[model samples]
Target: MGNINKDNLLYMAKYSAFNPYRMREREMGYTTSIGSSDALAKSLYCGMKAIATWDSDREKAPPTGGIFNLEFSPEGTLLVAACEKKSIQIFDPLTHERIHAVNGAHTDCVNCVKFLDARMFATCSDDTTIALWDVRNLKKKIRTLLGHSKWVKNIEFSVKDKLLVTSGLDGSIYTWDINSYTEYNLVYQRVFHTSSLMRCRLSPDARQMVLCTTGGLIVIIHDLNLATLAQDLHGFKPNLYRLMQMSHQMIPVAAMYDHLFDSKNRENRVEFVSDFPEGNDAEVVSALQVHPQGWSALSRNISHDDKSEWTCIHDIQPMESPCDKDTRDTSPVGRGRRTPSRRTRPRVYRVPRPMHPNPMATTHIQITRESERAAAGPSTSHQGGAPISPPQPSRLGLPGIQNDVWEAAITIKQHRLLQEMYNRGADVPSTSGYTPHQESPYTSDEEPAAKHFIRQNKNRLLYYIEETNEGKGFIKELCYSSDGRIVCSPFGRGMRLLALNSDCGELSGVAQDLSQPRLMVELGQSLGIHTDLVVSSKFSPRYHMLVTGCLEGKIVWYQPFSGESL
Candidate 1:
């Protein structure tokens, strides 16, 4: 009670309607649900229950500073942590017991660690070298591989190809052939290179690979070839857009679908990611930017917090496109110049000034009368003077007649359309014998394309306030559970285990709608599960166990199953 300040006390007291203890009971999982008595068993459990902690005794070991990365072994029997103290420590994940220690694992800070198998694993450091080690013998080093010219940032293993893949700040992807390693000559192949490589991973299926960079680009390599992109990236030609170079004249080019090589199945053309103009946030981004990423025109962002500005990014839509306006806003025009809700807005899609208009045939022409038929009669194939259709605007305009496009001429009277919906077609009412009006003028403006909002709002959630951080906060990483149910992340000082919503409620479980992800915390004013900044975390794949390390070099173990080890 004494630790609670006036503002915090007032914050907790804002909800004067309910009893505090009862709310805590439900939040701590001490109160049973209103259903069958079977739910009562869950009441005994407190979520994210702390099992034990890993910290060095001041006299026994040299002090460790901050924790950088954590990894669990493939067999789930051991865990490794890379530390800011320039050393590596091994711990029993379930018991949180320190099993082995190496004082100087690297010349500089250890950044990342991964297990190749149960007994053998690897670690990388700022010294630009990757060291392999055997768990059985911690004192002696196995072998250190040196190929990266800059700090190695990530490590991944391909079991199918029997290869060791690593990416570094040097922007090169190296694959070390494990079967052919020699002390004198290192056998590694450089597969791909980019400007700012930061992370790399092989797909679980071993069919594809991906690399992430600092400039917010994900390079997906299919068929493992650098010469041409995979056909799978091709999709229907960027909806009503032309690919163009961002140059002085903005020269237009053929859709990149099959233009790279002789592979010419132009059924699904695509636009490139570099096409979208950068924006402050997703809301203001142009919809045409959705083509390259195959989703929304989202990029870097900075969200408004309680006070300061922090970066924000949105969820991706894999196979759908999001609209800048409501679907109902697509009406041609509103009644009596009241301004239609769908009056085309310039922000939805920005066609580069030099880019060509959509590849559509601008106009159509028809024979006006029998006299206009060509002298080659048999080729015209006019059978017994069948009723001729009315003449359409000619494809080309001669000096005397102008080919024009009219803004969808309404067929019915304005009074008749008050409660009725009408079908619109290309046939002009003026051509169908209504009193012909003056020929319309030709304009350069193209009609806007109709886009739809996603059916579920869950897919388009925009987060604010909660994800803000500072300094090394950008380097801190979070991950989903092995089964992808819970999100384990380091919030400001402590860490949070957020569970996904399973119920189908309109407001997502409805008691106190924080408008944020479901946080698994004990009831009351306790914000998270710790008091110091948690800098790194790792999860066990075969069990419901989580381990995190703080800036003070204290490692905390989180487990749901109490009293026993998995």
Candidate 2:
């Protein structure tokens, strides 16, 4: 089996454009080419292109409402979309064919859709409910979760803990255990935010969360691990009131920023380190997306006009750089770049010592004599020989050895006097000695006061889109590929892809020509589906495929790398 896997890997390296080993080598600064042809070709492989489009039947008066969300199965086999109407559609990504459509899934518009596993998925609706459905049996819904009193805006599932977290417009957040498919039990609830909750997302490690509100507030809650909470607090249950009280002392350290209301008080406000020029008018941040690598993209309304939306991407400088070494040998000489030297034959030698007498042996001798006396019959004299006095103390009575060759050495008479005083438990005669508080004989200069340095944040903005569609269309969603190579967004009537640029440390278009700043895959223009706007887009987990949905009720599949329809 191991040999077979190795053979498969070798075959992929030889035939496929995606080369994992080559990418790693380039990242480590070991590549010999400085912008060579091969390097450019490898970079092109990371770029994206549109391939196919699947449009809804226009004559059927298809739901004119736009798609609100798009999600793909864990295996990338099926794609699902939540439409503005009370409907949920599933399509085969490989064939670009609609396999299932559930009409009247909810009483109101479906807002978000997410796949729990390969065979099960969940959708949230404006009807204040969440419905779970099995892909095999789309006609029959699996379960309905009821807790939020208002429109459910967002839902997220933690695969590690099998818990689903949902937020609603009623200013409440709830957590449900999905381990039992038949019964969805609410595990946690909180109503800490005063305004309506717009969205909630768990961090990549599931240790923190980022939440956005309709009032333009962004809140980050740290240390949100359920296991950590259960272990630290005794008899703790998932209740809103208890969690709110415990939040005052323990987990869920929160940081909030209300850019819209607090812009005038910049000095006292918690400002994110950004380089983008702040608009004269305050912008209401509506959505936030954070990448696993600490980068973030925020969508906001920069103007008074309702449709004047903007998206900005920021790069957070990591506390530690990737080049930091964990070992003492940071020199690259013996690293993978060079071969290690062979070990030579061992050589034997005799050990040499005697820098000073062992103090431990001297103490042991004294102990042995005392023990022998105790074991022997009571006698005034020593057991081994004549009565022996304790070793005489020198005039220079320090803790360790005294310098015998120096003129400061004590004479024999002085040593006898000191030994007698010690035996009698009397203080010895005073002598001159060095003290830390005393002035030095060599110099009179005073030491300098300690100095402290403050470090400033270096976070900067990588890219900004002020008017993606002439201030007409709003950004619906933002997604980063699983490999972190590309970031996609549904701007207007199409989708845009941004590739990471190594030179400028920003996301730029794939086209070399920069005259046109907007380089997007125009779905409407390419597919001739110009009736409505494209609203939702998502990337596959394991492939280069992308699925996009439009307001005209069309689900289009595209091969981003090859421009070849599947």
Candidate 3:
């Protein structure tokens, strides 16, 4: 409609339904009756041009092994990969050059790797331990956490709480206090799943956690901090009275529950949110990830041949009302007749009978001679008795009974003196007579009272992509883009990108009419360079590049917009 420039021409070529070639042919007076398939051909050509491509010259080679996982540092300065040969490789994303390779990083295969901060990262291995490393000095190990009895599968770091959450094949999830790198403490441990835990993901806010088990179970935990729950319940009518009552009965058992559940110890904290039904054809989930915008992506095998894998995107929807039922029964106050008990008469509640009668009290009296009492102090003696000799100064000179009586009297006097001093605001030391110990650095300070209750919606599955010819392989990993607009998974030598319908802020509303959604597949131009299956892939949070590593120890970086190999 306006003056066409080079940029407009290129845009029209890529996006317009009319093919640029067809338009040019039409301008040249080419006949439209050449074939009825012209319109379909034009659409196909447009779709082909829209597929992203990559440059082939940016491939990097590392010592050979399958790359299990890829992660970018929070600052996006370094890229790291966990390998199956007990090694870790670091690369520079911009140059596609190998930076450092830590050979023999673990005794067994390194299953997962995650960046804790800019300079720190953690790795889990089949050796049943998690090792922390410092990028600044990789010559020596930073620390090793030993607790899981089986192979560790996943590791996640909570930056806000300075905690490390690790899941193992033993079905246990362990939380560690990472405040002290050299001396980390196990803060909490629980058997969260019956089967082996496949993966664990912490939400962007670090307030929720999602875990997937090999048994096709998914568990979602909300309000990871009691303070967060306390704040969220500020105006929640249903939970207000319950939480208030819980605060009053904050006994040792309740504290234990809080530590285990990470909330007010209520049943709502941990939810058995969803699970693939038994006897269904759904495949076991192999990888799971939570988007920054509260959505989630999971990859599951759909067929027995292991060739068909599906990646499902889900939108989290909050319930209109609380899912929990009120603990109090209001039926008695409603307009309904109550049924009588089976017994003819109501049974009275009573305490259990005692086993035995109480023991009789025993009293002992001690009599001191008048001569011995007058000497202990300057108090007046009885008028009829002679002046008593001063009490012996040493216990060795007194009788056994007299010594015992005198010691009891002295102890009673000290107790009275201490109590009086305490009442008078004096500095009364502890009866145990031990100096107070300093608080440990790993201990958390009292969390501030939450101003409002944090509410989370249930996640709803939006759409799923089954295996196609271009996306055939066992899905090794799934990742979400920083903006939550796209989810990418590497299959075989190529990667599939699924664009979520996020025109609206929430994804749940766009569940319908998802037919023919945008999808992009990037297969490198190198003929045999990436013949092996891609084991790991990740999108840079700060850049437009996507990095992938394959089983043959080849790494490829791609620029999504131009599909140019970086």
Ten-residue region with minimum lDDT total, candidate 1: 399-408
Better-scoring candidate (lDDT), 1 or 2 = 2
TM-score of each: 0.53, 0.55, 0.55
Off by over 4 Å in 3: 1-62, 181-188, 191-193, 226-268, 273-280, 301-307, 322-459, 468-475, 501-529, 561-566
Q: lDDT for every model?
A: 0.45, 0.48, 0.50
In candidate 1, what are the lDDT values of residues 87-134, reduced to their tens digit?
898988867788888889998778788898989998987676788899
List runs of model 1 lying over 4 Å from the truth: 1-46, 222-466, 472-474, 502-531, 561-566
Cα lDDT of model 3 overall? 0.50
253-323: candidate 2 lDDT, tens digit per residue? 11111221132321212222322323412123445566644345444433333445556554432233233
State candidate 1's TM-score: 0.53
What is the lDDT ranking, best to worst? 3, 2, 1
Model 3 RMSD, rounded to 1 decimal: 24.5
Q: Candidate 2, residue 475: CA error in Å?
A: 5.3
Candidate 1 CA-lDDT value = 0.45
lDDT of 2 at 288: 59
Clashing pairs in 2: none
Off by over 4 Å in 2: 1-47, 58-64, 180-185, 226-276, 280-282, 292-301, 304-307, 315-462, 469-475, 502-530, 561-566
TM-score of 2: 0.55
